[model samples]
Target: MVKELDPSLNESEFLLEALRKGHRVDGRAVYDMRLIELTFGSDYGHVEIQLGRTRVAARVTAEVVRPRPDKPTEGMLLFNTEISPMASALFDAGSRSEEEVLISRIIEKAMRRSRAIDTEGLCIVAGEKVWSIRVDLHFMDHDGNLIDCACIAAITALLHFRRPDVTVVGEEVTIHPVDQRNPVPLSVHHIPICVTFGFYANGELMVVDPTYLEEQVQEGSMTITMNIHKEICTLSKAGGIPLEMDQVLRCSQVALVKVTDVTEQIQKALADDKVAR
Candidate 1:
């Protein structure tokens, strides 16, 4: 297993000192998030997200498949996350690391478990066939806060994706090509955005969108998933220093604000893409 080179003691101390003095090496305020940039591909359902130095690409694809017996009517939403070795020295090609696993799970919870997309709407035939919507997330760069970036990429791609039209007659399903029939958009119920907070100084100091060096120097972190409706989808704190109730609430408020901004950005980008095409 490859491991990241830990930051030196001096480097760590310098970052902490700067944070304590109310400054970040990247010049972002404690509560300020990094600028987010979205790039859409020529094909539908392909998107790339740039959050500062971090980069993630998401592609959405669908296929007709047998549905599960227990939930025959509901379509499947699957996520596959790959962290390239070129993204970081800590990652090995064609292998899943602990970090990659955690990121994938978090993304699953944020998007799939939250029911952001209308899975039941994907059913073409009850108990027999359903559209299996798969989201492939490729982590091209690992700066920090991969969970948030991956969620953004996946959700944006899903929103931009248009599946082929299908017709059924007497148990016979006919798939129409994009050229023959216009593709239809997915029935997305809501958008869930993830906002991560890195805690420092024993939880007294928290920063939004910590960079790679800040993540290394931080004591702990919490990830909050919320939608534009001000609904909390997930709150994840992994073995970090315990946070006070007020702190958790404060994080939720911040998450809501950030989620609103991101949702608008996604909508605007999609609108712009439609106009361009």
Candidate 2:
């Protein structure tokens, strides 16, 4: 389904003029990202991210269950998304929008398909019982760049989350509480971050971290998910204007640099949280 953004003649003209003059309403360069802030909740595996005006929260939880027969050695990793009406007037609580669907797909590709979390490491009893990790992302505000912010929130929450330690004695499973034993962190292979680029004027002009109004006026958008190692997890384009091959390569290169910076930020936040804890 087509997710339609409101069109405004006045806003379009204003943004176009600003871009033509090599300017942005928020005074950021074309490639400059808006300020990003991440806050961890008191509980384990809860994180809130603020990217410019967009806000997203992620909560991570785990449950023990029998592993799938086909993949008994591996645990489970699931991602779920929710968009609140307060996030945007265009959002319907009961229905999933194209943007929401797009976000979920991109995140799943980046996290699950990329194997960011070590599922095999999550196994305690192999085929008998294993931990199933679930990450839930909630859109608190939609100022644009929801995908990038959501990815950051989800991954950070996963990093911050700790699962209960389990001990199996003669097929009996015992889950230890935080007070009884120190919670263990998930074994993460690597982090994959999503960076988006918005195009305008037949792809002549582009910007990073577009505002909501800027998104409405953009001609096309592409999201690239990559890790600090410069490995491309996935590149997603959802019916936007066609981009040149060279343009795609250049954007991927830019995404590599951007993801590296984001990875550092996330690591620093985690380090601080550890000290606080």
Candidate 3:
């Protein structure tokens, strides 16, 4: 079996000691996130998000297709993620990784399973045809805290996406081009954003967003997905040393604040784009 080599001993030691002393290499507070930059392409439903050094882009497309046997009345929403070497060296990075799987699951729970999109609205002919929405996610960069960044990109793109105008006449479907008719937006119930906290010093010291170096030395981490309503869509803490109850509760409260700030930022970005359009 091949094993990954450890980080440089001196660099690792420096970061760990700095964190223990409440210092970050970037000179930011423990809770201060790196600057967030969200940009939209000329095309609707395409969004690019840059969280510090990590960058992600999401593109959403729609098509008409037969509905499923069981959920015939509902439309389909598919998510595919690509993490190329351009993103990070840790991954192969074109293929999926355990990290990729974890990121995908959290996003699915927060955006899809939580019923964020009104699938019923996607039905054109109940049990016969429906709209199929596919979101293609690309990781342009991977500094750290990728799951949270990816989730933000996914939900934001969904909010910005619109399906074409369609009419059904006696089992005949007519689709109108964008120039012919304004597209209809998706039925997004809510925007669920994931907030990640990295624990250090035996889970005693916690940071709101950890970069790659912190990730290497941190003891464990937790990701909490929530919306502007303070509803927790999912709380994820994969295998690691157990955290104290106080840590969990404190992180939850902090996560809400982060969620509120991020949600507002996204709304502002979308509104700006709408005005520009």
Candidate 2 stretches greater than 4 Å from native: 1-7
Q: Cα lDDT of model 2 overall?
A: 0.91
Please tell me which model should have the higher lDDT, number 1 or number 2.
1
**Predicted candidate 1 versus true structure: per-residue lDDT over 13-105, tens digit per residue:** 888888898888888888888999999999899999999999999999999999999999999999999998888988888879998998888
Q: lDDT tens digits, residues 66-163, model 3?
A: 99999989999889888877787667834679988888888888888889999999999998889999988899998899988899899999999989
Q: Give me candidate 3's TM-score against the actual structure.
A: 0.95
Candidate structures ordered by lDDT, highest first: 1, 2, 3
Question: Each model's C-alpha lDDT?
Answer: 0.92, 0.91, 0.88
lDDT of 3: 0.88
**Tens-digit per-residue lDDT, 1-277, candidate 2:** 2354586788789889999999998899888888899999999999999999999999999998999999998999999999978888878878998878889999999999999999998888878888999999999998999999999999999999999988889878899998899999999999999999999999989898788988889999999999988889999988879999999998998888889899999999999999998
Which stretches of candidate 3 lie above 4 Å from their native place?
Answer: 1-5
Report clashes for each candidate as comma-separated counts: 0, 0, 0
lDDT accuracy of residue 174 in candidate 2: 92
Worst 10 residues of 3 by lDDT: 1-10
Clash pairs, model 2 backbone = none
